[model samples]
Target: MTRTLFALNPGLDRPAIAAALRAHGRVQVRQFLHPDAAESIHEVLSRGTDWGLAWAATGKSGAHIRGPELRAMTPDARARFGLEAGQSASKGDFGFLYAQYPMVEAYVQGWNPGHPLDLLLEHLNAEPMLGFARDVSGIAEIIKADAQATLYAPGHFLTVHDDTVVEEGRRLAYVLSLARDWRPDWGGHLNFIDDDGDTIEGFIPRFNALNLFTVPMRHNVGAVPPFAPVGRFSITGWFRDK
Candidate 1:
């Protein structure tokens, strides 16, 4: 695979973006990455990586089943596992079904010695990317970020919740959309909710767009129905101060 930069787009208008963020408390930067980098990221996510299933049958914290081990499960065993998870979701318990590549965990634990996503993880915490995050967010206290690649495939979703990990020093949450050829009708929208649990607004999973918002805001990712043609691919994480 070609080495990717994960660099922000040189053409970005930083002042304009900063203003938008100031005004809206959230902003989406389209064509957020350099063209080649975005292309490489999308390619890697779609073809060159192993994916693991992530879900939580009860509360907010999720457990994962790695891809290879999940594949090795007997069909009935797999079905039973999924059915249990689905049943929890049906009961309105916090549940989700999606694929993820846990970037920060893999990086720190030496899970894959030279994995390509590791490069991206490091970039998120280093130099210009870190500095850019501080500048735009107007939160100079932000020191680093954690990242993970996410794929919302057909029938996958996330329930509503605010990102409130105070112990983790999370100051802002971000999602960089890499999904291409995704349709509005296909679901997979990042939606914001009000105190009443009604959706106030939503953003489509558009290619090469970045969304950033202050933490502790109510939000959820809408499910991608089975009829969708592509997975909603993205790298999501929180900028932290601690």
Candidate 2:
């Protein structure tokens, strides 16, 4: 039997979430998943080490390369990807690990059939959850979901950008936090920016919380400082329309 990935709180009904999204263009649902399910998914991601290093220079295609391959890029290629020429490839900023959607689904189903993450993604893209997303975002044609596991270790960060790639069909963006007992002071906040480039709000990664927002909004992941004891982990993705 496929396990239910989320057990919605009674207070977090569809209408309530829709109201919040309508008012703010974003909403966060706390305790979004059952404790056992959340724990299992968090365990798997926390112990797994097969993460690919992902990086991108401004206006360049993001590359997922191993440590050695990143070291082997030509000077021009490095510069184009926002890497400093002549500097050690591993020494620059802008780095994170991402397990892309398809690979993650395949790996989980192949190795641990009916894994929580797989089931969670399935649930999110179907039925009441999908309907809820559509209703809340007021985007009736949202028909697809894409997701990936992201890990921001010490010193890792993503720069400001509006998720406006229309070709990707993204209509809404979502993040499910699996980090436990996270601290705001340790960084790794999901921050929103205004037109003047000022930060208006930010969210700490709280375990079992799901954050969803309209796409094309400006945002960035705050850097995880070196002294932070734990890495920030989440499953993040976009809801798309055909």
Candidate 3:
């Protein structure tokens, strides 16, 4: 998966992604592939990440997943890296996954990577994921890249919430779905709340699909399932710091 994704695009999609998030609350960016990228990424997530005991009481969750020398892991691959499972902030029924890549800690913290991170960066820059800051929040040009993965099981839900708290130049909130060829009977949809915190803009969560939205708005994922065994898997992250 990681290898395929890396081979698909290479890096992030700045303009298109920005437009999608700005217009539709989220966007699904395509990924390129590399031979062993996916398997290696999963290995890092499963054992290399050092989740420690903090994740025991909680589930796999974090703020930064993509950074320099970083690779996003897959479900089957994460077992080797040490994956954690936990409920959403508002709802406990729906569980999510989390892990962090410290190699890019410096990049997410402050250092600028050059231009906006896109799929094109990997082969081009010394750090493919490194790029200029451009999301929302408007503060520092470069900020920490806080990202993570989320999986929602049956009867699980993430009550509406927003992702804009850190002050940075265009803070980014994104989610990439991993579940493939699934039916709607599967629960776990991200609902974007309007300004009044009522009404929904959309409920998106497609495979390899990336949704980027500015913070400050309310949103959530879930609604349990009346069907059989169908869950939601994706990676959610924000470009910011504590």
Q: Which candidate number maximizes lDDT?
A: 1
Task: Name the 10 consecutive residues with the lowest summed lDDT in model 1.
Answer: 77-86
Ranking by TM-score: 1, 2, 3
Taking all chains together, each candidate's TM-score versus the true structure is: 0.94, 0.78, 0.54
lDDT of each: 0.87, 0.71, 0.46
Best by TM-score: 1
Model 2: residue 10 alpha-carbon error in angstroms: 5.3
- Model 3, position 58: C-alpha lDDT score: 37
Candidate 2: tens digits of C-alpha lDDT, residues 1-242: 44344654445567787888889888888887777667766776787434545666433456665434555777676344334211222454333333333334544457446655566667667776677678778899999787777777766677777788878899999988988999988899899989997999888999989899898888888878879898888888888996
Please list the residue runs of candidate 3 whose C-alpha ends up more than 4 Å from where it truly belongs after superposition: 1-14, 30-126, 132-140, 167-170, 196-199, 226-228
Q: Which stretches of candidate 1 lie over 4 Å from their true place?
A: 1-3
lDDT of 3 by residue, 1-62 (tens): 32332333456556666566667655546542242543333333433433311122134443
**Tens-digit lDDT track of model 1 for 5-64:** 688888888899889988877888999998889998898899977998787776446777
Give the worst 10-residue stretch by lDDT in candidate 3: 115-124
